[model samples]
Structures are given as structure tokens and as C-alpha cells.
Target: MNTGSETQMGIIPPLFCIKCGLEHRLPILIMTAITEQAIQDCMTQIRQKQEPHHSLEIQKYAQLRLMDFAPLLGEWGIDDPKNTPKAKPLPNVAQAFQAAELSAEQKSKLLNYLQQAAKQGSTTAMLYLAYAYAVGKFIAQNPTKAVECARIALKHQDYRAARLLGEMLAFAPALASDVLQNDVQIAAQNWVKTHPKLAQNAEQIPQLITQYLHNPIVAKFVAKQKLQQAKTMGSPIADQRIRGLSMIGVLSSSQPARQYQSIENWLENQLAAAHMPIESDDDMMILPEHMPLMVQEDDDVPVWHKAAIVGGFLLSGAMITLLIIRFLVK
Candidate 1:
């Protein structure tokens, strides 16, 4: 299915090692150390001809390591020891999505390139494909295909996919109930798998997941002013998001997700989320916006009941006025 944006090749199933776990907060030095070790391990496997066999959720740590060196990966850092990339991956995921071309042939190069990169485990690449199919941009409208992409990306451990699927659960056309249900089930499983490390672990995570937590790229990630802002908000989802950003890598950290999210607005959202409350503790008895919009039959009172309540208030007022007058006269 290669169409020339990249070299002729089968678009592998773009997988991510997205984290479904809680958090991986670490200082710069520690993070640097972790990244160095992860690179060694990943390269070791690459050189040994062994495939990454960790669970999709566990691969998130690797995802960060790969992204830490994306510049190199894009260049000759980790090419096929046998053949180099034809032309330093075109248009990245950003430039490709921004083009105004409407013809499929014109877009084939961009689409094929992204597909190839995604198949190679590029988070942005997978994300781009999810949005392309979901919205039918240069592709057919296929919510099922969109769901499949987002779902696999979710298992790879990105929150944007979860967020996209959640939105689709309410808005995407024609998705079967099971597809939506499975989205939830997968998310829950990922959350649980990493629950113990949600906010209170680092040394405990198995090496498979932590091998790359140390890296200059990761230090840049944790040190991002925006990333710090996300952590300060202190919501569970925020915690997952910070981890998501780390899993996504610093290169695309400035990029977008869930259809590019106004340019990764999901990640950029941390800046905007600064004003948001960690949780709404207001006891003002507000109903959720998603609740049924129809009138509440039980809450509706009869005309007579409304009239009686009004009349009773008037009568009480008159009685109070009369009593005040009598006291003044005395």
C-alpha cells in the first residue's frame, strides 16, 4: 500500500508503548540516567533482532525513550542497519495534516508516510491516522477504523485515544455498543495495571517499564513549565495526562493529539487547566448537563398546588402585618 511519501513498504501496525499507569514524576538527573539505560536496552534488542514483546501498556516507557531520540530516529540514529530512510520522513505528522489538498493521490504520499511511521510505533503517526479515518479527511469516513486505531493506541497507553473514544461514545456515528464498551474496559485495565504507581512509585515499576525513564529528553519533559502546571492541578486525569505527555515524547509534546487537539491541545491544555479546579466540591446541587433534558414529571406540581402555596404565603404575610400593627397600637 505504499504510495511514495515514504519508501515502498508495508505500513506496520503503528503501536505505542503508551502508559496506562498513573505517574512517573522524577527529577532531571534521575530521568537522564533512566533514559540512557533505556536507549542501551532498546538498541540491545534492535541489534539482537528481538522484537519488543512487552504489553502495550508496558511499552509506554519505551515510547518515551524512542521519542527522546526522535531526531536521531528521523535521521540515522536507529535506521535499518541495512538501509537508511529515503528522505528524512516528510511533513512529520503536522505538515501533512495542514495541507489543503483534496485529492487522494495528492495526499497518498503524506498518508502513506504517516502510516509507515505509525506502524513503526510513532505516537503522532498513529494519532494522525485515527483522526484521518475518524473525520474522513483524505480518507473514507470509518468510525470503526477510527475506533480500531484509537483503541490500539490506547492500549499502547495514550490518553488522547481514550479521550477521543470517549467523545465518540457520545458523538461518533455508527459505533456498536461493544466497541464503546471495550474502550472503557481497556482503559480500566490500563489504569489498574499502573494504579500502584499512579502517584507513589518509581523504584517499584519493573525495568521493562522504567528502563527509559531517565533521559535528557525526559528531563526536558518533566521540566516543561506546562508539564509542571499539569501536575500542580492534582487531578487523577491530570496525573494520567502528565504521564501521557512523557510517553508521547518531547518532540510531539509541543504537537497535538486526538485529531491534533488544536495542536495537541490535550497536552497544551495543561497551560489552560491552571485555572481549573482539581475537583468541584460545590454542594449547590447542580445536575449534570448530560442528564435528560425532558421535564421531570415528579417535580412538576399541579396548578392548584402552586396556587395554594402562593395563597398560603400571602395569608402568613397578612397575619404578621396585623400582629405588628396591634403591638404598635398598644
Candidate 2:
């Protein structure tokens, strides 16, 4: 009985007004029926894939698998379409950096690409540019520019940049007085404003700054601090920095010596309880010789526990003395 747009079963009925039972609208009626053949024809057209021209499109396609578009492809009835155009691969930050040794024109081209990517709001590109500026890699070192780039990334809500900025503020002596004189604590305070949980305790600010100062970036800063102090003051620990970095009253502690001693005692007690020798040779008890002398400055000390340095010495000394007394009696 159905003349137009027949499904496998039958023609679909047109929507009608329930109360009036008015005759069906022609356009609405026409739209009601969709046959299997129509679906197949629509799918055939969708399967006729066209290649993309834009570089961004190509990059996006290459980075994301075709399967990611499965839902859209399915809806369009496109499957296994060929000749999906791929864009030429852009060199990553590392590649571009290494290619700095190439000819001037080539390097310049690469730098331009990176700059464009940064301008386009690529956080990765911004970070690489920041690093290049910070370390003088393939470009004249400019810490100010590096900091600026890092700040830009932070504005974009990049947590890596936030941590990096923290490191720069805490460790970089070039920035210590000029930029970070009061900024470290101020920055932390600002951060705490939004992330209120970080400021739940009174000690959180100092604790957070301490963690930042312990980052790998601060290693160079700590070493430089030690060297400068050793040359001028002839004492490494005499300076307040080794006590722990402080600015604007955050991370400033007067009792680092006592705190360090307590840590040393706790670590020694733990090791003694375990009966583990402090060094490879079980007989040696001279803790100072075995333990590193560069305590405050050295960040990469082999001992995992900060207290272990002093604690190991005391524990080893006590053990050796006991052994010596036993030998003398024998």
C-alpha cells in the first residue's frame, strides 16, 4: 500500500495531531521514512574520503589514530577510507635543539617554527624555549626571558611551570635578591589563596618552600652557596641559607642545628635497632671519615635519610668502641 520511502518492513507513518487527527504535513511525512538502501547510499558517499590540506589537521591526524574518529566514521558510514593525507612531521623541541649545529638558515627555520608554535599557545614549546633561555643552549642565556616564558606557561595553568618557577625563585642566585627577595613567600601565599588546603596549617608555607628548595634545580644553588661561603667566610654552615632558605619570614628557622641533631639521633637509633653496619667494612667506626663532610651543601648524598649522616657516625663509633673494649679484655 505504501508508495514512497519504504523500509524493509513498510512505510513509516507520518506524525498527526492526536486531538484533531489532522491530515499529515507533507514535509514532515516525507522526512518520516528512511530505508536501508538510503542508509547504504549515504554511507557510500561518506566512504569517499577526501584528504585534509592544513598542517594542523595532518598533525592532529598523525598524533591521533583514525580509530579515534570511529563514532563519527560510523555515523557517516565511512570505513577504512584511504589517502588520509598526513602532514610533514615537525621536529620536536629536542630535535630542534640538537639541530642547532646545522647551517644558519636551517637552524633559523627551526627556531622560527618553535617560536610560531609558542605563539600559538603550545605549552611544550613554551617550556622548551624557557629552558633554552635559562641554560644558554643554542642561544645566549637570558634568565629574565626564561622566567618570563615560565610565567607565561604558569598563566596557562601549567603545574610544571609552577614547580619550575618555585625552583628558580628558591635556588637561582641571579634571581635571589632581585626577583625573589620577597617573591618566594609572596608567590606561595598567592598560590595558597586559591588552593586553601595548602595553607591549612601555619607551617605549610615553610614546609612547601623547603620542598621546593630540595628540588634538583636547587642543587646548583646550594653548591654555589657553599662555595661562596667557603671562600669568603671559611665556614659553610655559618650562612643562614644552609640553615634553610628563607624569604619574607617563610622557611626561616633559627633551630636548624638542633633539628638536624634530633634527626641525626632518630636515624642512629633506627640503624642501631636494625644492627646494620654503616659501611661496607664492618670494623671501621670513624663516622666522619666514612660519612661525607659536605653535609649541608650536598643534596645527592648516598644516605637517603638526612639524620643517617650524623646518626651513622655515632652508632658506628659506639659499636667500634664496644668491640675495642672486648678485644682489649681478651
Which one is best on TM-score?
Answer: 1
RMSD of 1: 20.6
Predicted structure 1, TM vs. truth:
0.33
Compute each candidate's TM-score over C-alphas: 0.33, 0.30
Q: Candidate 2, residue 160: CA error in Å?
A: 1.5
Query: Residue by residue across 1-330, what tens digits does model 2's lDDT show?
Result: 011234212111122222332222111212223333443343343345433332221211121211122221121121112211111123454555644366668757766876887787765566666666555455554455666786676566543444444444433422432223133444444444554432344233343343343332333343333333332422222243334344433232333332122222322333233343344456655443223234476557565576778899999999999999999999
Please, what are the lDDT tens digits per residue for candidate 1 over residues 71-136? 222322222322222212334455555665546676888778778887876645665676666555
lDDT of 2 at 131: 61
Predicted candidate 2: what Cα RMSD to the true structure? 31.3
User: What TM value does model 2 have?
Assistant: 0.30
Residue 157 of model 2, lDDT score: 50
Give the winner by lDDT: 1
Per-model root-mean-square deviation over C-alphas: 20.6, 31.3
The clash numbers for all candidates, in the given order, read: 14, 0
